[model samples]
Target: MDISLKNGYEELGVAWRRGCEFLGTDYAIMGGAMSWVSERHLVAAISNAGGFGVIACGAMTSDLLDAEITATRELTQKPFGVNLITMHPELDQLVNICLSHKVGHVVLAGGVPSKETIRRIKEGGAKAICFAPILALAKKLVRTGADALVIEGMEAGGHVGPVSTSVLAQEILPYITEVPVFVAGGIGRGEAISTYLRMGASGCQVGTRFVCAFESIAHPDFKKSFIRANARDAVTTVQVDPQFPVIPVRALNNEGGKKFIETQHNVIARYRAGEMDLATAQLEIEHFWAGALRRAVIDGDVEFGSVMAGQSVGMVKSEQSTADIIQELVAQAASAFSDHEVIRSNP
Candidate 1:
């Protein structure tokens, strides 16, 4: 569990491009944004450790989001980003909050970033980072003024695109013209990050791994659940069928999730009868999540909640500080770059 800097890949650093600069950092990693979990403490902690951290915007009012931004500024003078769900009605106000606080970057998640929205972000002096499901979408987002791209795969948590990270990365990387790509989904260990770095990704946006970090605010049960999870522990299921389109999310399968499927029918039936609202349905969906995470992370209910983890969870066996994790990941990347096997094997 110990990664001694002396015995590992020396001169570890990640080269990346964001906005107008090709920047290099001690580590090419980001603490992925998790709903109701990411805050100033966690974001700042990761950024201070030489990795990017994104604050999650699950259900924050303008005032509270502003406060969180201010607190993050107070915590670290280093760079960080704010993750905003595009479907949220108050998206503009939240974007402004980040601008006013001088947050250098804003990561738009859950949906596409519109041209107007990207224009507004530019006007506010913040760089836009948007997620794309495919190469076409990635190109479109770059045209819309996205400073960079977060290409997510089907293995991601919450609302996600149908494509797997492998397909998405392969389809998009070479085709996209300018903006740098940050791969999201199913990343859990130093070796995985190293693999992606070799795959033309600028860095890895890691949400689930950060959830298990000591500083995350998710119920202790949630963190502990991740502690014991292997790759097979997580699965994605359908809760509500959207008539427009459907996307699958990866999560831990448990009794609570099974109960949720049964409840989804009753709830959707009420919605169809015009007796329930979208907000109510959303609450019910998260209710299942809270209960499940409560069981897995809190009550030692590994078989109890819908724990969301990436496929690489099998590679993790112990928890370490954010700094230690970054160091190890970057060291691995450096080793991979220097290793002669790939060179010698090539004709």
Candidate 2:
């Protein structure tokens, strides 16, 4: 690398060095844990490429998670974390599995984790990382002994909050300084990562961009859907009736998405007619997409499965190696500084 570029890279490193140290990775960039897609192969690949990888323990049983951690360990000696859904039936057992494997970091995602969950993770000697959608929750997580925080905005794929990434960063980044805060949602480029780091974020998390990584086990059809999508193509699920209260999920619009709207309407109608109680109606609506993500990701059901993707899906052009993807992001971030140095010297 040229001295100017080297300097630029070093500057970028300095900005996210806290994240690097916390994650024990070469770069502060974290691979977003997309269930069914972020398995052992992709997780290990991201870590091996100098970025932190996280296993998505979404709905995985204790034995399943145990085997996955072991498989990922065989692939990469680098540090990686496991993401556990707070709503999982066996959350405690999953945590135990991670601790047994001596995982360095544990990301508690899906919803606000209980203080006891955070305490247990820390007590097991692994750092606890939680997602804070808003400023108030960010502070609460910190007080609850969260070692790190990831502020994910609505633009992110899968389940999301209402705010945009930029807005969330501004709201939570400044207030939560006790621990490292990683920014997520719609972050596809290195420039965005650099911008967040400059804004006092310790690092950034990316998911949609990694779906097309060569190491990802997602169906080819799934990757093609991402490649063919524009920002507008990736949209959040719409609720036909506000009373039923469907959680907003950002995903590529498809037949399944359209069906989801119809399903919500049907469920609401049945509830209004007294065919079922409100709880049963809501349960039916939620169950509609239960296995939808896995269908699209693993079984090539792009037309009907939930193809979750962020607004950054538009930025993914082609399938590339995990290392190449990380390198591109790093290069893009470093170039900003290099360009500035070149201008300064010539002037």
Candidate 3:
């Protein structure tokens, strides 16, 4: 792969171009934060390797987040960020914890972030990154002071939105120029990253491929599942009852997923029988997977734990170092640039 003419993918849009500058990293690639999977070791390794790393604060208390941030700082002196879910009960305190630690970046995921949350992050001298589910929301997030946006598609692992990456890029990128937009979901290789950057994304966020990283603490069985599975093996949960809201989550199909379907049916039937109210029944359904991810990631219960994974799980063939993964993606992107140049020159 002759990448001499690629020029390090400098053709990406200005917003993402500035996003790299804002992140203070050599590359704009961000290791998407996955619950129970992203921790100090993986986060530090990603940052030290030149791509951005974000600590996933899924259901973590303020004290835990503080300790995680302190530990990550000790591992690598490079810049890294913390990903805080919007629905977190301790949202304010978590933001305050990041502020107290002088964290460089805070990514707000799970839902649209409130303006006050965005303001607090920015006012604390940290960059605020929000998830944009649609073009309108992308523009609105910018208006609310989001420094950058991550447009994640349904093909992503864990909790996901409805749109695909390709369609979201087409719909949101051309219109929203206020901030850099990082495309996520279904991005498996460097070529795809290059394609999104050319389409106006500032960079890309990847999760599934990194789940098996050598630095990742995910259980061996969980990593093995990712390695052995193909894209088709990852499917989103379907809503068994329309009355109860079901936010689709992508994961490797296993015994846990099968049981979750049955569990939902029973819970919905109880609700319909007037034995339980809507909220309590919904909570019962949601709580089914509460501690399940941890079971898969830490306890090696792949058979009955949530093995959250994106479609890109198919490309994760082995457990490599985080540096190797970043280098591979960078090299692939550079090669794609060179290939494009060759075709343009020939034409």
- Those runs of model 1 whose alpha carbons end farther than 4 Å from true positions after fitting are 1-24, 239-247, 265-306, 340-347
For model 1, residues 1-347, the per-residue Cα lDDT tens digits are 23333322442343343311422344557677875667888888888888887888767889999988888889887788899989889998988888888777888987887898889887988888888887777888888888888888877665666678888888887777487788888876666665666667777877776776666666666666666777777777664666312245577666766776777777777877998787786566556555453455445565555566666665556666767766666666666555534455575
What is the TM-score (0 to 1) of candidate 3? 0.96
Among the numbered candidates, top TM-score falls to 2
Q: What ranking of all candidate models by TM-score puts the best one first?
A: 2, 3, 1
Ranking by lDDT: 2, 3, 1
TM-score for every candidate vs. truth? 0.83, 0.97, 0.96
Q: What does candidate 3's lDDT look like per residue over 67-155, in tens digits?
A: 99999999999999999999999999999999999999999998889999999999999999999998888888898899999999988
* lDDT, residue 238, candidate 3: 77
List candidate 3 segments past 4 Å from native: 1-16
- Pairwise TM-score winner, candidates 1 and 3: 3
Please list the C-alpha lDDT of all candidates, in the order they appear.
0.71, 0.93, 0.90
Give a tens-digit lDDT track for model 2, residues 1-347: 68999989988988889999999999999999999999999999999999999999999999999999999999999999999999999999999999989999999998889989999989999999999988888888899999999999888999998999999988888888999999999999998988898899999999999999999999999999999999999999998877778888999999999899888888888899999998899899989998999999999999999999999999999999999999999999888867766888899
